[model samples]
Target: MKQILKNSPPTRGIDHLAFVTDDLPATMGFYTKVLQMKLVHVRRVPFEMDRGQPPYDNLRHYFFDMGHDQLLAFFEYPQGLDKQNRDLPGGMQHVAFYVPPEKFDDLIENVKAQNVNVIGPVALGGRFWSAYFYDPNGIRLELATTRLSTPGGIVESVYQSEEEARKELETLFDDPETVDYWLSQMPLKHQ
Candidate 1:
């Protein structure tokens, strides 16, 4: 509602989401062995280049294939940083990865077999359900899947139905017309 800006047309999905990890072996193990993500790339960044990168040239940055060609990356910083609190503004609380429903239970069992405690298959208010756990980096992660079967797959599974969204939005918006306007812009109807 703030601006009538156009959405980016050429862009696709996320390329990567970078996180900080102190232990590369443990992080790599959990991601590769437990979660089954492949380690695709690893390198040291040159400090003089990429001005926004960590100041040290020896910093190790590595990537894991987080499915659909998206990379999940991590940086092993030398020192002098505190553990981040997800409650802080602009911090990530958790990341949820989509799992096909067929693979959901097996993934959860595999995680638990590796001694990771999980807290779901909880209903996320739509067809989507999830199991939450922590990585070696202490990053909360969720493996989510849908109970509803459809060709749209993960995207369709998580999308809110008009009735479900309107019910929640009604409590927040004082104007029904505003909700209707946004709902019109949303692709809530199934194809």
Candidate 2:
């Protein structure tokens, strides 16, 4: 049985997702041609009226409409710009884009044509699959497709209220057997 907590703010879904790219044209090319996301807007940050500072300069900005009113945005900075890699162990990890289960393989093939380093179609438990690739800026991205959530099938954890999930986690404290099982299920990097 499941229980619901009172007074939790419901998610209203994504507004936008952003990334920094060294090669703006190439990055835009991949999202447009491969993933089929459409370019819907472009703009630069206005840094006008600064006191004794360098004149306001524009950055190359582009936004893609990733459907459901969500935008995927990228900012192109010149080479040797500040960067961070999200691949460190226990790092702030990957971003996932959902796709129809049937098109998942074709999506992989399309992205592969761009010659990006990618891995998987890996199992994320039964009936769901994920593929991983790194963007030009070394940010890992995932394309996940699931057929696992159909009615009367094995229930998978996809959405859980934080408090409810936390309560379940609280039971793991000092329980060696449960802790061991939980630890074993984590990816190798987290072990």
Candidate 3:
């Protein structure tokens, strides 16, 4: 059995994530038009030519606010990178962003208007609702809102205490005698 130690809280979350793209302008247009992410910043990294250069290099960087302090960034090299299938296994999974419950309805409507296949503002219980869609580059994304209780307690079972959960599991479908026998078969640590 593992020894017990205090649990530490997670530190500050993501500031941004960067992806390399072949066509910078097309990608920017898609994010702005479909996703409604604003173009927050753009800059170029100058290549230093020996002494007192006249022309700055052409490498470019772009940033978009994906809400919160979270960001979506892209880099455009003069000779661009390959476009990889983001949906492949071990490839880019989906990105989910939090939304206010009130805004979820509007967000759902906006995303659908983009003609993208949007699935569910389906309430997972509580006040949470989540909608899923694919971005222009075929990257799957989820927009979600936390409602009354967190979503999991509604869609998925949740236990306030492990002991309570364990007791409930033990009593679920069995008589006392079968429960006792089954409990004996479980590992001591799990028990």
C-alpha TM-scores of all predictions: 0.84, 0.68, 0.60
Q: For candidate 1, list the clashing residue pairs, or say none.
A: none
Q: What is the lDDT of candidate 2?
A: 0.70
lDDT of each: 0.83, 0.70, 0.68
Off by over 4 Å in 3: 1-10, 45-59, 77-89, 123-128, 149-191
- Residue range 1-191, candidate 1, lDDT tens digits: 66443454476888999999888888999998889899999998767865787766788999999999899999987555688898889999999898888899999999989999899879886676889999987899999888875636555455677997788889889899988877776657553
Output the lDDT of residue 180, model 2. Answer: 48
On residues 11-51, what C-alpha lDDT tens digit does candidate 2 reach at each position?
Answer: 66778887778898878888888778999898886556745
True lDDT of residue 149, candidate 3? 44
Candidate 1 stretches with Cα past 4 Å from truth are 1-9, 48-50, 161-163, 175-177
Query: What's the CA error at residue 149 for candidate 3, in Å?
Result: 6.3
Candidate number that wins on TM-score, 1 or 3: 1
Which predicted model would earn the best lDDT? 1
Ten-residue stretch with the least lDDT total in model 3: 153-162
Ranking 1 against 3 by lDDT, winner: 1
lDDT (Cα, 0-100) at 151 in candidate 2: 21
